[model samples]
Target: MKTETQTTGEQKGFYKLSSLQRIGFGSGDLAQNLIYQTVSMYLLIFYTNVFGISATAAGIMFLVVRVIDVIWDPIVGAFVDKKNPKMGKYRSYLILGGIPLTGFAILCFWNGFSGSLLYAYITYVGLSMIYTLINVPYGALNASLTRDTDEVTKLTSTRMFMANMGGLAVGYGVPILVQYLSPNGKINSPESAQAWFITMTLYAIAGLLLLVFCYTQTKERVVMDVKETENVKVSDLWTAFKHNGPLRILAFFFITAFAMMAIGNAAGSYYMIYNVQAPEMLPYFMALGSLPAFIFMPLVPAIKRAIGKKQLFYVFLTIAILGMIMLYIISVIPALRSQVWLVLVAQFIKSTGIIVATGYMWALVPEVISYGEHATGKRISGIVNALTGIFYKAGMALGGVVPGLVLAYVGFDKDNTITQSAFAEQGILWLVVVIPAILLLVAMFIISKYELDDAVIDKINHEIESRHKN
Candidate 1:
C-alpha cells in the first residue's frame, strides 16, 4: 500500500507511480479489451452469420448504438465530474459499472433470443451505455494518476501492452475456445451459438475480476478540487472542445485511428474465411492484429525519444499503409494469393505500425487534459474523456456501419458459408486493406496538427500545479 507521496518525493502534479500501481491501473484497459474487443471484432460476424440477422440490419443497429453513446457519454462525464462518490471518484465505477458491463457483455453474445432484433438492440445498447459509465471514468483516471509526462508514457505503454494482451486473447483464444466448446469444430456456423455464449461468459467474468484488481491497485492523486467540480455541466464539454485546440486535433485522430482499426478488424474474419479462402487461418490472422503490440509497445518510450512523437506517428502510419498495399497486391496476384506465410508477414507489418501509432495516441489524452487545465482554471477530466469517447465511438460506428453496408452492397450472403462472389471478396479486401490504409493516411495528417510535444506538456503541468500551490 505504498502511496505516491511515500514512494516518490516528486513535486505536486508530477508523482511517479510504482510498477505495481502502473500495472494495476493498466489492467483496467486489459479488462475492457477482453470484453469490448470481442464485441468489436466478432459481434458483427456473430450477428450476421450465426445470430440470424442481415448484415445491413446489424450495421444499422451499430450506428444507432453510437448515436445513443453520443448523448449518454456527456451526461455520464458531467455526473462523474460533479459528484464525489464515497467509494472513489473515478475508480469506484471500475466495480459498480464493471458488474453490469460484465453481465451485458455476456448477454450480447447469448443466443437465447436468436434472430430477435429487439433482443439484440437491448443487449448491445445496454452493453454500450454501461460501458461508458466505466470508460469515461477510467479515461479520467489516467489523468488523475499523475501529470509527469514520462510517467504517463510509461503508464500508457503498460496499459497498451496489457490491452493488447487482452486483444490477443480474444483474437487468438476466442476461436480456440469456441471450437473446443462447440458440439462441432466450426466457429462460423449457427451450431456454434452455444460455444460463443460460453466463451464470452468466461472472458466477461475474467474481465470483471481484472476490473476489481484495477480498483484496488490505483488511487486518484491529481484531480479537480470539490469546489471546481461542483458547477460542472454537460455544456462544458462543448466549451472545452471549442477552446481546447489540442483536444480537437486529438479527437479527430482518435476517430480516424479507431475507425481504421475497427474496419480492418471487422473485416479480418471475412478476409481469411472468404478472400483468403482459409477459414482455418482465421485465428492466426486475427491474432496478428494484436500480436505486434507485444513486440513493439515496450519500445515506444525509446522510439519517441529518438524520433519525436509526430515523427514516430508519421513513420508508423506510413508503414501501416505500406503493409496494406502489400496485402492488396498479394490478394490480387493469382500466384501469391495462396501464400499464407506472405499474408501473415504482411499482417505483422501492418499491425506493427498500427499498434505503435494508435497505442501512443492514448499518451496524448493526458496531455490534452493537462492542456485544458492550464487554459481553464478547472480540471474537467471527465468532460474531456467524454468528448474523446464520443469521437472514439463515432469511429467505432463507422467500423460497424461501413463493413456491413459494403458487404451487403456486394451481395454477401450469410447462407453461403463456404464462399462469396468475387465482388464480395473484393469488398472484404477493401475493408481489410484499402479503406483502413486510406484512414491511416488521414490519421497521419490529423496527428500532424497536434502541437503539444512532451516539453510543452511538461511546462503546462508545472504551471497548473503552481496555481494550485498559490
Candidate 2:
C-alpha cells in the first residue's frame, strides 16, 4: 500500500547544522519575538491609552487585518515555492519583509495619526502582511534545514529558548523603557505618547539588526529541485490541506495555543492593575510569564526522551491548568489579592507548563512538511507554513478581538486608569484564568489527534529522501 519514497528512515548528513549555525538560526526568532511579543503585550494598551483609539475600533482593526492574512499568507507561500531569489529562496524575505516590518511597526505606535481609523488600519495591516512575508519563509526554512527528526528537536529547543529570551526582554524591558522615557514615569499616562514612539523606534531598529544577524548565520540544505519547484501553485495549498492530517492537527493546535496566549497576555496589564491591586508590580508579573522558559526549555529533548512527546503535552497542559486554577483562587480571595508573592508563585507554575508545551511545537512543523511530501511527491514547505500561519493569525486575531470586546462589554473606562468597576475587574480575571484554561483543555484534545510520533515521522522523512535519490 505504501510507495518506497513514503516509507524510508535515514537522512544522510545533508541536513546537519553546526552549533554556530543553529544559534544563528535561533536568533532570527529571538529578533522577531522581541518585536512581536512587545506588540502583543502592550499594543492594546498603547492603542486605547496612548494612540487615542477606542477598544472596539482597535479590535475591529485586529480582525480585518488577520482576514487579509488568511488570503495573503497563501499567496506568499505559493510565490516562495515558485521562485528562488539570488540572496536565497526563503532568506531573501527576511530583508524584503524585515525592512518594511521595522518601519510600519514603528508607525503603528506613532500618535501623529491619533484618532484616525484610516491610519491605524493602514499601519496595522501593513505590519501584519509584512510580518507574514518574513514569518512564513522563516518557518519553511526550518523544514528546509534537515530531515533528521532529532536534529529538528534540538534546533527547535534552542530556537524557543532564544525566542523566550526576547520574550523576557519585552516582558520586563518595555515597561521599564516606557516608564524611563515618560516624564511622569507612567506608561499608561496619556501624555506618554511621545515616549511610546521613542521606545518602539529603538526596539524596531534592534529587530532589524537581529534579522540581519539571522541572515548571515544560516544556509538552506534540503529543498525542492527545479522539477518540483515548477509544479508549485496556489492550489497546492488546499491540496496539501485537504490531504495532510498532521498539518491539520498542528494548525488547529496553533489556533488554541496562540489565542490562549493572546487573551491572557492582553489581560495582563488589566489583571495586575485591577485584580492583583499591585500596579507597581506589573513588570515583574509580566516577566514571570517568560521566566520558566529559561528553566524548562533547555531540558526539552531530555524530557521528550524520558516521557515521550504526547505524554509530555499531557503533563504540561495539566500543570498549566492547575496553575490557572491557583491564580483564580488567589485573585478571588480578598486577603490574597495583594499577596504579590503568592501571585508570583502561581505565575511560575503556569508559565512552566505553557513554555514547554507551546515552545516545543515548532519542532513538529518539519514532521508535517515531511508527511505532506511523502504523500504528494512535492516538498512544498512554503505552502505548508502558509497554512499554519493562517490558523496562527486567526488565533492571534481572536486574542485581539476578544480582549477589546470583553473590556468594552465590562465597561472598562479608558479615562480612569487608577481603578475599574468590580464587573470590569472580573472581565480581566476571566481573560487571565477562565478563557485560557478552557482553550488549553481544547488544545489537549486536539493534540491527542496528532498521530505522527518520532518514529513514524523519521520513516516518512527517510522515504521522501529515498525517492529524491532515485
Candidate 3:
C-alpha cells in the first residue's frame, strides 16, 4: 500500500488551488463573518439600548455565555475530529450548525419580549453555541484543504478578504438599513427596533444560504488518518495543552488580540452616537475600519516575506497603539471635535494596522498543527482548533463584558434622550481609545512569545515528511 508520506509529496505545491476553488473557500468566511461581525458589532447595543437590558445585566450575560463556550467548543471539536464521515467531516457542520444559527440570529434581533432579559439570554446563548459548532469545524476545514504553506497563505488572505467584505456590509450597511426600516428615524421606541429585527432577519437568512454554498463548494484533500479512539476524553485535553508550546502561545495571542478588536468594534456604535453626536455617520466610520483590507490584505504575503511575521506584527501593533493615543488626544480637545473628518482619518490609519495583522493570523493555525505533528505523531486538527476556539471565545467574552460594564461604570441611563451624562460620555471615550489600546499592547507582548518562524516551520515539515517516508 502507498503510505501517507508519498501522498504528502504529491500534495506539495502552490498549484493546489484553482481560482474558482479559492473563491469557494473564501466565500465560506464571507458567510460566517456576516453573522459573526453582526453579533460582535451590534448585539451589545441591541441588548443595552434597544432590547432594554441594563448594561450590567448584559455584561453578566456576556461573561456567562463565554463560560458556556469553554465547555461547548471542545465537544464539537473532538466530535468532528474523531468521526470521519463521507460528506467531508467539517464542511457538513456548515449546514447542520448553520441552520439553527441562522434562526437564533433572527430571534436575537426580535423586539417582541419588550425588555425581557430572559428572552435575550435564551436566544443569544443558543446563537453563541451554534456559532461555535459551525466555526470550530470551519477553522479545522481550512487546514484540511491543503498542506501547502503558500497556498494556505493565499487562502487565508482570500478568506480574510471575503470576511472584510462581510464586515463592510455589516458595519456600513446594517445601521443604514435599520434606520431606513424604522418609522421616522426613532430608535428608542419598540417599533423602531422592530425594524432592526426585520433587517437582521434578512441578513441572517442570507448568511445561512452562504453557509450552504460554502459546504457545496469545498472539498477536503488532506486529513489525519487516525483510528477512531474512544469518545474524546477530557484527560486528552490536558495532554494536548501540556505538550503543545506553539498552541499555548497562539491561544494567548488569540485571546488578547481578538478581545481588543471585539471590544473596540462593539463599543464603536455607542462612541459615535453618544460621544461624537453623529449617529448618522456610524456606517461610514465602520466602513473605514474594514475598507483598508483591500489595500493591505493583498500585500500580506509580500509583507511577511520582507519583515518576517513576528516583526510585521510588532510594526503594525505599535502603529495601532499610537493611533489610539492620537484618538484619545483628539477626543479630549474641544477644538478637535469640530474636525470629525480628521478623527475618522485617524481611525482609518489605526484600522489599517489592525485589520491586516489580525486577519492574517488565521494562517498560523496550520503552522501550530504541523508543529504538534512534528513533536507527537498525531495531527489532531480539531483539538488544536478547539483550544484556539476557547481563547477566541475568551476574547469575545471580554469584548462582550467590557462595553456593558464600562457603560454601567459611567452610569449610562437607557431612559434618556438626546444627551447623556458627563460620566457616560467619559465611559464612551474610554471604550473608544484607552481600553482597546491597552489590550493591543498586551497582545503585542503575547505575540512576542510565538517562537515558530518560516525557517523553523520548514525544518519541522521536512522532519515530518521524512518520518512518514519510513
- RMSD of each candidate? 1.8, 3.0, 2.2
**Candidate 1 worst ten-residue window by lDDT:** 1-10
The stretch of ten residues in a row with the least summed lDDT in candidate 2 is 1-10
Lowest lDDT sum, 10 consecutive residues, model 3, at 1-10
The pairs that clash in candidate 2 are 8-463
Cα lDDT tens digits for candidate 3, 1-470: 01222243363311376667777888888888888898899888887778888889998899999999999888877888887777677898888888899899999989889689899899989999899888888998888777667778888988888899999999999988888888867544455788888888888888889888888878876566655333455455557778988788889989988898889898888778877787888889888879999888888888888998999899988888878888888888878965789779878888988988799889899899888877777667787898899998999999999988988888888776357888899898888888889888888888899998888887877677666557
TM-score of each: 0.98, 0.97, 0.95
Off by over 4 Å in 1: 1-8
- Cα deviation at 283, candidate 2, in Å, is 1.1
Q: Report the number of the highest-TM-score candidate.
A: 1
Q: What is the lDDT of every predicted structure here? A: 0.92, 0.88, 0.83
Q: What is the lDDT of residue 403 in candidate 3?
A: 87
Error of 1 at 379 (Å): 0.7
1 or 3: which has the higher TM-score?
1
Q: Please give the ranking of all candidate structures by TM-score, highest first, separated by commas.
A: 1, 2, 3
Better of 2 and 3 by lDDT: 2
lDDT of 2 by residue, 1-470 (tens): 12222223434523566788888899899989977898899999888887778889888888898899999999999999889898988888888889999999999889997878899899988889889999999999888777777789889998998899888888888888888888888877678888889988988899899899899987777778766688899999999989998899999999999999998988898888777878778888899889998889989999999999999999999999999999999999988877799999999899888999999889888888888888888889899999999999999999999999999999988877788999999999999999999999999999999999988987777676566567
Q: How far is candidate 2 from the true structure (C-alpha RMSD, Å)?
A: 3.0
